[model samples]
Target: MLLDEASIRRESEHVEDHIKRWMTVEGHFRILTALSTQMTQDAISVAKTSPLVSELYGRLLTGSALLQLAQSPIDRVQCSLDHSGTAGTLLADVWPGPCVRGRVEHAQSTQAPLYGGDGNIHVSRQPARGGELYQSVSPMHASSVAGALQHFTMESEQVITFISLATVVDDDGQVTMSGGLFVQALPGMTDEDLSKIKGCLAQAEFEDLVVAGDHPFDASAAIFNDVDWIETGTDPILYRCRCSKQAAVGAVRTLSSDELAAVRAGATETVTCEFCGTDYIVSAVDLDAS
Candidate 1:
C-alpha cells in the first residue's frame, strides 16, 4: 500500500466532509466512514506502517468532530477514546477552522488481548482562543471503532449518519490510500431525496476508492440529489499544532529570573506540540533575558 501524491490529491478532493462543511448542510447531510482492513490469523492488519486500527480511530474522531461542529457552531472539538481494551486510549482533535491533529498512546504492540470488552468514547469542545470545555461519553458495542461511533451518534446525538473508511497499506509500510465518507439524514427531508443519497453512496467505487487513494472525491451530485445542497468548499484538514517558542519564552518570563536560569542550566525546558510533533527547546540564552 504505497501512498501516492496524485492519489491523495484526488481523495482530498471530496470523499469526506469536515465539521465546518457538515454544519453548512445541517439539515440534509449525514456522515459515513468505513475501512478496508483484512484479517490475518483472526488479527486485523493495516498493511501499512501506522496500524489500520489507528486510522479507524482517526476516522471516528473525524466523524465526532463533524457532529460536534454541528452542535457547537462556535467552538472546535476533539474526540478521544480510552479503549484500554487493546492499546491505551486514542485521541483526535479538529477545529472549526477545520484544523486536525491526533495520535495514539501506544501504537507499537501487535495486539492487546480482550476476549470481549467494551470501551468508552469521549467528545470534547474547547473554545477558539480558550475557555471551558464540554465533554460527552458513550459505551462501545462493536469491535470496530467506527461502528461504536455510529452507535454513539444515534443514541446520544439522535443524528443518523453513515461512515465508510478504508485503509490499504502495503507490506512496505506505505499507506497506499486511506479515506472515508460521512452522510447524514436531514430533518424534513423527503424519501426520494434520501434514496438518491443512498444511490450515490452505493455507486461509489469502493474498491478503486481505497486502492485509488482519492481523498476529495466528488459528492456534489450524488449525496445531495434533489435536496438543496451546497459545497462547503475545501477546508483542508491536516496534522498540525498550536505551540510556539515565543509562548514558551513568555511563560519563562512569568517565573523569577533565578528560576529561568535554573531551567536553562539544566537545558530541561522543553515544550512539545502533541498535534504536529513539533518540539520547542528553551536554551540558556533564551532564559538570560528573564
Candidate 2:
C-alpha cells in the first residue's frame, strides 16, 4: 500500500530505519531511498557474524528492502547470493511489514572479498494472496551486492535500473549505517531523462549522500535537487522473523528418517531459526505425538 505525504513525513521523522519511495512528475523515473540502521543492527545481532559478513549481510538486507518497494504491498521478496568463494552465501527476505530477515552460510574467510568468485544472484517474489511463485537468477556483478542486484533486475526484469548500496560498520563490529538508492527507468522514460538521473547519481555519489545526511529527504534532495517528485509511499524497515515453534519442528522433521530417529533418541533436538537465531526444541514426546 502507498502512504500519503502525511504518513511519509511522519514515518520519516519518527523511524530511523525506513524506505521512502517516489516517482518523478514526468513519470519517467521511479526512485527508492532507504536508511536501515536499526534493521542492520537487528540482523547482525541475530547472526553474530564476523564484521565482513555482517556488512555483506546488511547490504543484502538493504537490497531486499529496495526490491520490495517495487512489489505490490501484499507481496514478499527474497534475494540470495551463492558464490564460489570463501566468503560464502547470503540470503534476505522482505515482506509487507517492511521487515527483513536473513542468513549467511559457509563463511570460510572473513578477509575474503565478497567478490572475485563465480556467483549467481537469485530472486523471487511471493504473492500474498497465494499464487505461483516467481523466481529468476542472473550472473553476479561480483563487485558488490548492489551491482549484482542491479544486473539481476535489469536482465531478469528487462528494465534499466541504477542501484547503489553501502554498509558502514565500526571497529566494534556495530553497523553505524546501512542503505542505498535506486533509480529505475519507467515506461515513458527517455534516454536523455535516464542519462540525467544517472548523471545526478554519479555526481552525488553514495558517499556524499550519506556524508551530507543519511535522511531520505537529504539524499533525495542532494541527488535530484532541481527535479520535481512526490512521495509515493513510506514504510519503516524492521527486522522481524517468521519462524515459529511449529515451523522449527517441521524443519527438523525434514531430516532423513534415520537422522530423525538418531536425533529423537537424544529425547530432545534443538532447532535454531536461521533468520532470527531463536531456538526451539523437539522432545521425544513431540516426536511420539507427531
Candidate 3:
C-alpha cells in the first residue's frame, strides 16, 4: 500500500505527538519514529500516573502511533496491555488520526511490572467506514512494552521486524523524552540487506538519539548513512479524548425506558470518561427528550 502524504496526521494545532515515516529507496524495509515530548507527558497525565507507570504508558502511545502504518489513515488501530498484574489493564486506544486516547483501569495500581509478568499485547483494527474487525495477540514476555508490541507485529505478520522504544523520566518524574522505532523487512529485500540495516541501527545509541538536538527523523540519516532512504511523510499524534455531554446522554439512552425514567427523576446523572476522567453532567432535560 502506498503511504499517501494526504494521510499525514495534520491540519491540526495539536502537533506535539507526531511521527515521521519512511522506507528504503529499494523498498526493502519500512521505518517509523520520532522524539516525542509533550504528547507523552500530556497523554500519561490523563491517568495521573506514577513514574513507573509513565514509561510503559509512553511506550504504548509511541508504539501505537508508529504501528498505524500497517493500515490506512482512515482505519483504526487499538493497542491494549491485557494483564492481571499490579497495574491492572492499560489501553492505548488510538492512532495518529482523529482521536488518540488512553485509559488506565486503576490509576493507583498502574505501577505494576510491565505486562504484569504473564500478560499479552492485544491489537485490534477495523475499517473507518465500518467492517469486520481484525485482531491479534502476542505474548508480552519481553523486557519492555516496545518489545511486546514488536513481538505482536512480527508474530502477526510472520516477517522480520525490529522495534525499539525509549522513555526517559527526570528526577521529578516528568517525561523527558519518549520515542519508538519500527523497522519491518519488506518483500524482495535480501537477507544481507536486512542484516545491514539492522547492524547500522543496532550501532546507533537509540536512547541518546531520542533526545538529540535534531529531530529523530532528521537525525536518523546518521544511522542509515550507508543506505538510501525515502520519506513517506510526517504526521502529528495528539492525546484527544472523545467525550462530551451528548455522548453521555447517548450512553444513558442505552438503558431501558424504565431505567431511563428512574435516572431522569434524579434530575442529573454524572458521566465520567474512563479514558480521561472527565465528567459530564446529564440533565433530566437531556434524558426526558425523545
Candidate 4:
C-alpha cells in the first residue's frame, strides 16, 4: 500500500509537539513515542495472512514514533510490531543510544517454566540466539500488550518509563488499528523528579483519548498540562522490509555443493523472508554458476 506522505508528516509533527510539551515540565532528556491505527492494522494483517509468517496469532499491530530531546534538535526513532498469542517471539535491531533492533517471543504454553500468569517473553538481541526470558506478573491472570511492553522496558533497563497502549479489533477478529504512548526519563534524573513525572502520567486520560481517536500530542498535553513547549521537527514512520533477492541468493550459496545441487534439482526452489513474508525464487542456472 502506498503511504500518504503528507498525512504521515502531519501525524509525526503532532507527536513531536506532544514530546516537546512534556519536556517543558520535566526539563531533562526524554523519549516519547506513538503509533497510528492504520499502520498497526496493516502490520497485523501481513503477519496473519502471509504464507511465510506464522509466529504471531490473535495479534495486534503496534507502531511507535520516538522523539528524544537532545542538543541536536530531536532524535527520531520508529518501531513497529505485529504480535499475538499467549507466547510469541520477536527479532530486533539495535542502534546507537536507546534505539534497539531485536525480536520478542512470547512462550505459547501456559505450562512453560518461564510462563508468568500472562506469558513468557523472550527478547533476542541476536536473531540466531534465543534471548533473555522475562515472565509476566499480571494480577488478573491474563496477557496484556501494555504488560508485555512494560516488561520490555524494565528488562532493557530504561529507568522511569511510562507506557499507555490500546488496540481495537472488529468482531470478525481483524485488528482495525492500534496506538500507544511512551515516556522515558533519561539517566541522572532524580527520584523526586521521576515521581512527579509519574504523577502526571497517572492522571493523564490516556485510554479515553486513545478510544476517542485523539492525536497522540493531545495525550501528551494532558500529561504535561499548561507547560510551554517548542516545536522541533517531525519524522515519518513506515513499515518496510530490508530483504532483497540478492541477499536470498547469497544465503543459498552458503550451503554445501551437495545441498545446492539438491535444491537445483527440484522443480522450483524458493526462499521466503520470515520478517516481511517476501518470497525469492532460486534459479538452477544461478546455482550452477555459483
Candidate 5:
C-alpha cells in the first residue's frame, strides 16, 4: 500500500494583492510545498523495517518533488543522487502533475551513516512520451540533500535555485515528516523581479519555514502584481511503491530452476523491494514447484 498522491494549487487573490502592494512586478510564478503523508508512510516503513537504507533515499524523493515543482515551466524532470561513499544510489522520477516515485538501491535494516564528499547528482528533463530528454550532472555538496540540489542548479542550469528540506525521525529513528520547498528564478524574468523574489525568499528564511513544524507553512509567491487573478492548481504529493507480488513473480519466472534452488539454499529466501523495503518470501518448496 504505497501512496502516490500529487496536487497543484495557485493563489490568485493573494498574488493580486501582492501585486498591488509591490510597485515592481513581473509575470506570474509559482511557489510550491510538497508535504506528503504517503512519503512519510513509505519512508517510515522503509526506515523502521530497514533503518540503514531508507533515510537518504526518502529525503531524495521528497526533495525531488520540490525540484519538479520549481520547474513549473518545464514539463518533467528526473533527479538521481549517486553517493559512492556510504549511502547507495537514490532515484526520483517527477512529472507535471508534480507526481513522484522513487527508490533506494542496496537497502538494509540497520542505520548506517553516509558521507557525500565526492558523489554525482544528476537532473534531467524529459517531456511526456515525445520530447527529447535533457540532463545535467553536478557534484554533491557537504553530503546534504538540499545543498547538493543548490549546487546542481547553480552550476548546471545557471538558474538560481533555492531549496530547504527537513525530515523528522521518530523515537525509533524512522521518518515522520518529509517535506521541503524550492524557489527558482524563471527564465525571461527581469533582474528586478528576480531580486525581489530572492529578497522575499531570504526574508521568509527557507530553513525556518521548513523546520518550524508547528507554524502553518505558506507558499505565498508574490511575483506578478500587475496581472489579474487567473486560476489555481494543486499537487498533493505522496509516497508510492511500484512493487507488486505479480512483478516479483514475473521476475522469479526468469530464473532457471537451478538458480532458484541456489537462491533458496541461501538462508532467508526473501526478495526485498529496493524501492520501499517491503520483503517477499519465497519458500524453497514453492520455488521447487514453480
Candidate 6:
C-alpha cells in the first residue's frame, strides 16, 4: 500500500486545494492539512519498534512539520524528533529559489531545560539566511500540539489573530490525519473584529472536528462556519527528496583528491538521502568527469 509518486502528487494536490480555498486575504494567513495512511505506515516501518512509539513519532512529526510551513514561504521542511520523544528539530528551506533556510529546536522536561525552565515551551527561531522576510518564534507554557502552534502564530511578527491545529493518528497505527487552520487580521482591522474572530475560533473545537471529518476541508469549514472565504489557488506538497545521481557525484567531488583517487580504486559510492531514504550511486567515471 505504499504510495507511488503519482499517488503522492494526487494527495498533495488535494491538501493544497483545501488550503487555497480557505484563504481570505492575500498572504495574510494560510491553512494547510495532510493525511496519508501509506506515508505514515512507511515512516513507522522504518522504526521497526513498538507501535506506540512509531505512532507518536509519526503524529508529532506530521503535525509540527505542517505548522512550520504555515508560518513561512518555505517550500521544503524537515523535522527530526528526538529518540526520547520529548524534543525535536525543524529545518525549513525554499531551495533553488532564493535558498532561504531556518532551524528551530525545542525540548520539554522538568530536569533538562533547553529554552527557559521546566514545563516552559522555550522555542527559538534562527535568522533566515537569504533574506529577513521570515523570522519569528512562539514560546508558551502549553506543550500540546494545538497549544504549541497557537503560541507560534501569536508570537510571530505577523498580525495573526487566531490559529488552530489538530492531528490524529489512528489507534492501530494504520492512518495519520492532520489539519491546521490559520486566521490573520489584515492592516486596519479593528480590535472588535479581532476579538469576535478569536471568540469564534475559541468555540470551534477544531480537534474534534478534525477527528470527525474525512477531509481537511470539512474540518476547516466546521471550524470557520461563519467566516466568508473563497478558493484562491493551490500548491502541491509531497514527501519528496531533492536528491539525484548528479548531486551524489557533486558530493563526492567535495572530498580531497586523495579520497577521490581512493574511491576510484574501489566500488561505486552510494549516497542516501536522509529525508526520503532515496539512494544514489556515483560511478568512478562520474567522479572522473567532475
TM-score of each: 0.68, 0.83, 0.85, 0.62, 0.64, 0.65
Off by over 4 Å in 4: 1-22, 29-31, 49-118, 126-143, 172-177, 231-233, 262-267, 288-290
lDDT of 3 at 69: 57
lDDT of 3 by residue, 208-247 (tens): 6765633455457777778888888877767778788889
Candidate 6 wrongly placed segments (more than 4 Å): 1-18, 21-71, 74-140
- Candidate 1 weakest ten by summed lDDT: 35-44
Clash statistics: count for each candidate: 33, 0, 1, 17, 13, 0
Question: What lDDT score belongs to each candidate, Candidate 1 first?
Answer: 0.54, 0.78, 0.73, 0.46, 0.58, 0.49
RMSD (CA, Å), candidate 4 to true, equals 8.0
* Steric clash pairs (candidate 2): none
Over 4 Å off, model 3: 1-15, 96-98, 109-116, 211-215, 288-290
lDDT of 2 by residue, 1-290 (tens): 98898668746553568788899999998888888878888888888877777777888898888887775567888899988756677888888867788887743347666544787888888885678898888778757788888888888779898887777778788877677787888898998887788788877777446644465456667788867898988878889898887886787788888878887688567898777778898875666665
Give me the displacement of residue 170 in model 3, in angstroms: 1.7
> Which is the better candidate, 3 or 6, if ranked by TM-score?
3
Per-residue lDDT of 290 in model 3:
50
Residue-wise C-alpha lDDT for candidate 6, range 1-290, written one tens digit per residue: 78788667757644442233255443334445444334344444543324444434444444444454554434333322222223344333333221222222331222222222223233333333433343333344454544554555566545564445544556564445654555556666666656656676677666667667545556566656666666654433333335677888999888888878878887677787654456887778888775
lDDT of 3 at 225: 79
Q: Candidate 5 at 41: error in angstroms?
A: 3.6
User: After aligning candidate 4 to the native by TM-score, how far in Å is the CA of 26 from where it should be?
Assistant: 5.5
lDDT of 5 by residue, 1-290 (tens): 64433212222221111111111224334445455545655555654435434545656776777676655335567788887645567678766555566655555534345636678888888775658888888778746777888778778768776666666555575554455666555557677666666767656555455445421144333222332332344455655555776666557756787776676786335677865667787655555554
Root-mean-square deviation (CA) per prediction: 6.9, 5.4, 6.3, 8.0, 8.5, 7.1
Superposed model 5: Cα runs more than 4 Å off: 1-25, 49-58, 69-78, 84-88, 93-113, 124-136, 174-176, 214-216, 219-231, 253-272, 279-290
Give the higher-lDDT candidate: 3 or 6: 3
Pairs of residues at least 3 apart in sequence or in different chains that clash in candidate 3: 17-237
Give the TM-score (vs. native) of candidate 2: 0.83
Which model, 1 or 3, shows the larger TM-score? 3
Better of 3 and 5 by TM-score: 3
